[model samples]
Target: MRQLLQDLFDKRVNQFVSDKRSKKLFFPKAETKQACLANRSAEIVKVKAAGKIIEESVEDEFQTIKYQAHYQYLIKQNGILYMEEEMEDRLAKFYKNALVMDEEIRPILESENDPETELNHLDLEDHTERLSYAYDRLKAVQYAERWWNSYNPAYKKFQNDCTNFISQCLKAGGAPMRGYPKRDAGWWLQSNNWSYSWAVAHSLRLYLSNSKIGLRAKEVSSPDLLKLGDVICYDFEGDGRFNHNTLVTGKDANGMPLVNAHTYNSRMRYWAYEDSSAYTPNIKYKFYSIIDE
Candidate 1:
């Protein structure tokens, strides 16, 4: 009888292994096609913009053309940054897959009657602890020196590097990438492009509510605020060419806003207006607050 039972278990195990192998052979893992397509499209857009800039040989040109080209380059770089961010997110998800529970811990808690079952709440707590541990472990792995050494030259560009770093922080904090709209420097360079102030305003509106970050649009203002993570946008000329953006990292000793941004000559760095070369002439800036719920 014991021999029969052992044979039965062996059969089951063999069948499970066969099924797993078959699945792997028949259906390979899904590629990140959506992200790849977006990246490719962005590249095409960049090439077209570059072509247009090259074709323009008129000796007498508007002052704004230089600004337009600068913004176009910015958008192209932003597209690359977005793609890098998606790659990091995919890596984080791969690591997280191993730590997620196979069963619901909540149902066990709600249905529990016996003392031992009630103590199962500890199991739920343990799940949360495990998730945090997994997140930390994944982040460490993702950011290790070995991983940095493995980055290809294309991925080593400044915008991509900064966005990848930021993506790691967001993932570690348990934030998903669903709500924020994807944007690039190209979006700002078009002739009838959306205003920088409007883009920041709308993005802030979506982020505050969607991110559960407690801040609201009605609360945003220039003098009354500007918190860490708040967004500031510039209308480069008083004629309403809203063309620049920066995120508030912190305040200076004198209570002025310090920002991080990418632009024509300025890559990524924290800057106060007094120290920034990207400061616009004859322009009024708009400030949008990000409320953390």
Candidate 2:
């Protein structure tokens, strides 16, 4: 199934690149196009282009695919059923806590646009106080390994581990999960089981669409345009379906963007473009930033 998914993804990407509509409408800007052409020409001249090396370096930083196959196989064999269940349950708890955190930070988000009003409300030296509040709220919700161990062994293994962590981050940042069906425990709880990808994706969509959070989606070309709390969506293999999602943490020493993601193969890890090993061709990526200001 994994191989099939990869092949299908690759085929879709190849078709997309080969399509005339995509070539004309979706190509990078003149500057980026020129750079791509120049790099290709340089590769032809010396059979070794420095830019190609750099691209390879960027792709290599992500090592997700190496372990994805193993996990996929385990899932297929039902060997990790218990672990997956544990993860789902733990994720549910995490989501519950995230809901609470969002409530606690409501004042901060409400005052995000007005620095003077925010400063007046809190006794602080500068923006550091608010920033520290945000950071501490985020840190307090992060459950380490011990929290994971508290779950049943079976429920811990095969879940969408990265999305679970990211959900907490989103809540810390004041994005509450809304519009979910009511359950005995919470308002956002759903009776149906959702894929990890779906849970995170829908949660984000809900938050952005809600008037309270006020995150407006935007079109972005390069990772450089992304901010610390921005969201990146990937159409792995160039198909219309956006399958992967990540958060932009910051930039690396070489100025490449670093991402936090829980991918099928990579689990949870920091990734960058310089690592070619991480690049899966035919993926059309889109970015969106939360509108705090």
lDDT of 1 by residue, 79-167 (tens): 34211110110100111112111111111101111122111111111111111112232342233212332333323223223223223
Cα lDDT, model 1, residue 28: 19
Candidate 1 TM-score to native: 0.31
Runs in model 2 deviating more than 4 A are 1-158, 182-217, 264-279
Clashes of 2: 30
Residue range with the least summed lDDT across 10 consecutive positions in model 1: 85-94
- The lDDT values for all models are 0.29, 0.33
Query: What would you estimate as the lDDT of candidate 2?
Result: 0.33
Q: Alpha carbon lDDT of residue 108, candidate 1?
A: 13
Q: Which ten residues in a row have the lowest lDDT in candidate 2?
A: 85-94
Q: Write the per-residue lDDT of candidate 2 for residues 35-56, one digit (tens) a residue.
A: 3323323111111101001111
